[model samples]
Target chain A: MADASPIETHAHVLTLAEPLPLDSGRALAPVEIAYQTYGRLNAAKDNAIIVCHALTGDQHLASPHPKTGKPGWWSRVVGPNRPIDTNRFFVICSNVIGSCMGSSGPSSMADDGAPFAMRFPVITIRDMVRAQVALIDHLGIDRLHGIVGGSMGGMQALSWAANFPERCGAVLVLASAPRQSAQNIAFHEVGRQAIMADPEWKGGDYYTADLDDPRKVGPEAGLAVARMAAHITYLSEQGLTQKFGRRLQDRDAKTFGFDADFQVESYLRYQGLAFTDRFDANSYLYITRAMDYFDLAEEHGGRLANAFAGLKTRMCLVSFDTDWLYPTSESRAVAHAVNAAGAPVSFVELSAPFGHDSFLLDVPALDRVIEGFL
Target chain B: MADASPIETHAHVLTLAEPLPLDSGRALAPVEIAYQTYGRLNAAKDNAIIVCHALTGDQHLASPHPKTGKPGWWSRVVGPNRPIDTNRFFVICSNVIGSCMGSSGPSSMADDGAPFAMRFPVITIRDMVRAQVALIDHLGIDRLHGIVGGSMGGMQALSWAANFPERCGAVLVLASAPRQSAQNIAFHEVGRQAIMADPEWKGGDYYTADLDDPRKVGPEAGLAVARMAAHITYLSEQGLTQKFGRRLQDRDAKTFGFDADFQVESYLRYQGLAFTDRFDANSYLYITRAMDYFDLAEEHGGRLANAFAGLKTRMCLVSFDTDWLYPTSESRAVAHAVNAAGAPVSFVELSAPFGHDSFLLDVPALDRVIEGFL
Candidate 1:
């Protein structure tokens, strides 16, 4: 094989001229999208794939994070010879609208040159898919090879098949649900309350001030607490036990103080603190609220099967056995609905101890499944 | 029934001149225990039964909670004609050490005329049982009829049999583990962080401020967050869905802001705020730490079975099917150890959708089991 082009990210920011209508009945104007593309599109444009990211994730699918310098969130699944191989299929990933990283979000300046902040229109999964469809239209792509995602990303992939079936040839969803469960909404509510409870939040106007100035800061503590609480739900009790079972963190015995005495606590603190460095608290609130309001059935006349009626898109659904957040039962529900719709579907529940995050983790079994499905 | 003796509350405060030894090699001098007793101690003192309360629970077992004006927490199962049957058994319940209610705790005055606060030595479940043993001695009780408890209270019951086997004739433990699980400790760590993160916590010195004057406040926000996080674990995900599923609090549509639009959010916020009125934040830290440090095997040469070797206490261990906090596996582990030690042990996993708090909630099947065991 000849030497290939060095892996590079092709960035695009589409300034949609039309107002984007939202589920909340408010309209967002002049929408700008930040997206990255990898690999080459075939002459027929039949090999282009759309990749979606989970909550707290951005468009840097296979590139280094600009702020944290960490490898791309899904680098494992999108690189050469990987499940979603760059060479086999062209890939496009975009930062969701409500996110902070290079997307039109709460921090983006509005019509009057002031940050939207709390004034940003409430978005839904269908809205996010609509924005993506606009970007796809702008690229002049007739159709997509597949739409792939896990967790919240999986929700978007499902929404695409339900809302615009002709846009994609196949849908591959992992560790996701068609609707937000009551427990799911409750956790998100706690996270939002934590962000708003912070005095530094300043009603989401902290972005107007100079962030470098020590005197003015965003709600880092509140955001960190929110991250910590949400992180627990993403893992299983068995996984936590095996990972950090009552093990002291760099100590011979318990300190009996309020400090992080266990390894799990220390790890959660690091994850939370590291997150605040690259994420905006307000963005966290909007995106989670969007997720809470996502219900495929509610959007389709209170019937999940109605969304799948006469669906021609080939679909592959995979769920992790340990993922309590979006358990295998959820995957089964989707499989049952689509099967009744007479859609060609392949479903598998992969065994992985990493819980809901197994989709992003190094599960070789998942790689085989995805490779075969593609 | 002799008119039920006017439903009196026989309260006592045992003042011991001797220094109460603790697990941390520290001692509490002139220990005082606040407790309440129901029914009369039989002529032989053989009908005396000790009822241990869970964490955040106090001595008002069958009596009205003065602050919240709610009926006694276990009034459903411990009344005259109920399962525990106060008319037949003398039940004694004490507010645990390190608790804020009535007992000598972080809020109690020290010898130097200041609240103990952080100065209070961290205690263990075994230590709480030791204090109760002193109270039993003060009441001139010997060879007690039974020792019953649920959750943390259940931990105390198990410790009594393991440490002082001759003190009670029977042991009834419910919805608890012999050792706190890794997931349990992780959740507790989140709560501690939430409490300490509040600026008003003042490093556990918030109690010295004008709590009565109301000119200033303590860490109510932090404590509320802590309570909210912990409360989620007490109920099953299904229970939450059944109670409140995507229902708006008081409006027809979403608020599109940080307000609690969902019913679950409002309920969680109320639970957290109400908790701050009757609980101490510092005590939350200490008791959770004590629980995290608990390991029955560590006290018996790293052999859990050794904790029950040659035991004389008859035991009945009950677990709730839906209680993920202390699941059926934990109860099974304890049963296996006791059975191996030739202890007369009976174990059952009851069905309840209420999760960890099912032992305190309405479950008539549990009442039958407890009655038969007693």
Candidate 2:
């Protein structure tokens, strides 16, 4: 694998304390955002692309992570000669406001120098995008060439096109929908409950006593169960059967005991444990809440078409054949709304063995589509 | 729901103290099986149809559960006018050897008068079938007209045809596989680990503690998590989305905190909690072990075709389009093996939004297929 590009130091932090009134008659304030950018802006500043990250992803889109020895989540699609081609376009990725990675979240120090925990204002997808817009103004960007993202990132991309149509020239959404499905929310809630049910969770305030409370609150077992459940959703049954069909874990005969007797079991355990290392349990709570609160058309009255009223941005929507999480029907709904708004749009369902995670995996077709669009 | 049919008094028990030599050279014994029959067996015994239950299901397939207020699991399919019409078929549903519902399991008393707990020998799918075969002999039945089941029950149905082709005339396997997939074993292991990790489990010996040891050993929270995880696999994403599309749990707005805010969460919790009342944690361990050990093709020299060698039984296999647990490919594999054996067989992938549980759900197409075949 290629080494990640070095982190740029020119990024800035912005804080806002003014309460932003919401459609639900609620107000959120005291938001702090950290953002980073790469490449140079053209005279017209139209080459800017904002990359949104998924549930646990951060702003390190094209750089090596500060703690983990891994490259940025989107390095494959954003580097030189890559789909987004960072050498030719300015790329900006921000740590989402409700995330734990150097952004305002439950883990961040509060007004009294204590961790915020559950004290942070509840945020939505629009709220995260709203903060991104503020960051865009801080960076002096007027128009974006495109806003691109998958999963939660895709939620942000859709939010930008709907909430701030004039700021983006194009939109690309992958493996996401207008809102979290009931099943999706249900799985997330299970994970959250697992964390909270842990005795160490201490009502989400373990950061004060220097307690290993997050470990407990995060419900490692519950989270592991949750991750295992979610992981199944990310793969096609065909993929799973092909990859690990009746394959025993480190044994030729069944141990008939409660050991990890299958490769799939080992894989799921690794995923759950690895996830806990970088992700804040509280961030999971907040981000899933934001996704649950998302309903683009609902914000613009009940008419979905009205959400994209007069939008001019070209939109490329991609759905995977096996991605039951956000099935093809959802993409069709978005395409319908975009069409009603007379916006330039393209949609395709790509054949992939992987399910919802296909967008993040190596899919040459996805690369080709993105490259062609760019 | 209609009341469960009264269980007939032809209950029989089978015990094997010596370890029964398995095809793998491994031995499993001290197996005691409990089973009950309903309806009258014809003189020819051709009216007998064994009903296999899914994971956590018991011999009370068409009878009122003695402990819980719930009716038999297959009540809908085994009633007077149902597909496997009890009025015509002498139904036999056994509590598989590894289960705890009136069966000799970890909860059964040993000669020492203490709960066997973890002392129960590890059982396999074939072992369960063998025990059932013993029961069939005790009842003086030379052959069965058919074996019908869904999920793990379906596994037993397939096992009957593969292991005792001469003893069965037709096999109706639904929503089951020839062997448990690696993913299936992995999920089971997670559940097992959850139970074992509970401090109160006391190494599965909680039954004799004179306290609510079952509650702890049952790992209610962990089991709930496990059930929630497994429940996701039981339904198609389309079904879940249609049933509970990101709707809040009794509220119109997101709680923005870590709580069961979604209806899906509430539903999953109900599923998990209700499961504990009727199921044993140790039984969960044993049955999952049996499922993981089930690879008929592996037992017959790694050739699936060999497992069905010279099979004389006709087979009717039904798979749901959304049943990811045992996808259509699995059924195809079984059908292919049966065809290789030159046995009459038919396969159909039924259309249903419900996932693996479609076999149990009221799908008209499934009814038509069963009615036509029977």
| Per-residue lDDT of A120 in model 2 | 75
Candidate 2 interface RMSD to the true structure: 2.6
Clashing pairs for predicted structure model 2, backbone only: A182-B246, A195-A217
lDDT of 1 at A166: 83
Residue range B270-367, candidate 2, lDDT tens digits = 89888877677777878887888888888788888888885887898899998877889889999998898888999999999998889878888888
TM-score of model number 1: 0.96
Tens-digit per-residue lDDT, A21-78, candidate 1: 8777888876899999988788888898999989999999988888888988888778
Point out the worst 10-residue segment of candidate 1 chain A by lDDT.
A1-10
User: For model 2, how does the per-residue alpha-carbon lDDT over A1-374 read when each residue is reduced to its tens digit?
Assistant: 23355534246577865655544456656677887787777888778889899887888887778768798777777776678776678888899987987878888877787788888777889888888888778768888888999988998999999889999878999988877777677667666656655544667775645644544344455455555656766777667778877676788766656666677877777887787677777777788778877888878898788888868879989999988778877888898889988998899899998888899888989999888887
RMSD list, candidates in order: 2.2, 3.2
User: What DockQ values do the models have?
Assistant: 0.67, 0.54
Best by TM-score: 1
Model 1 bad stretches (over 4 Å)? A1-6, A211-216, B1-6, B214-216
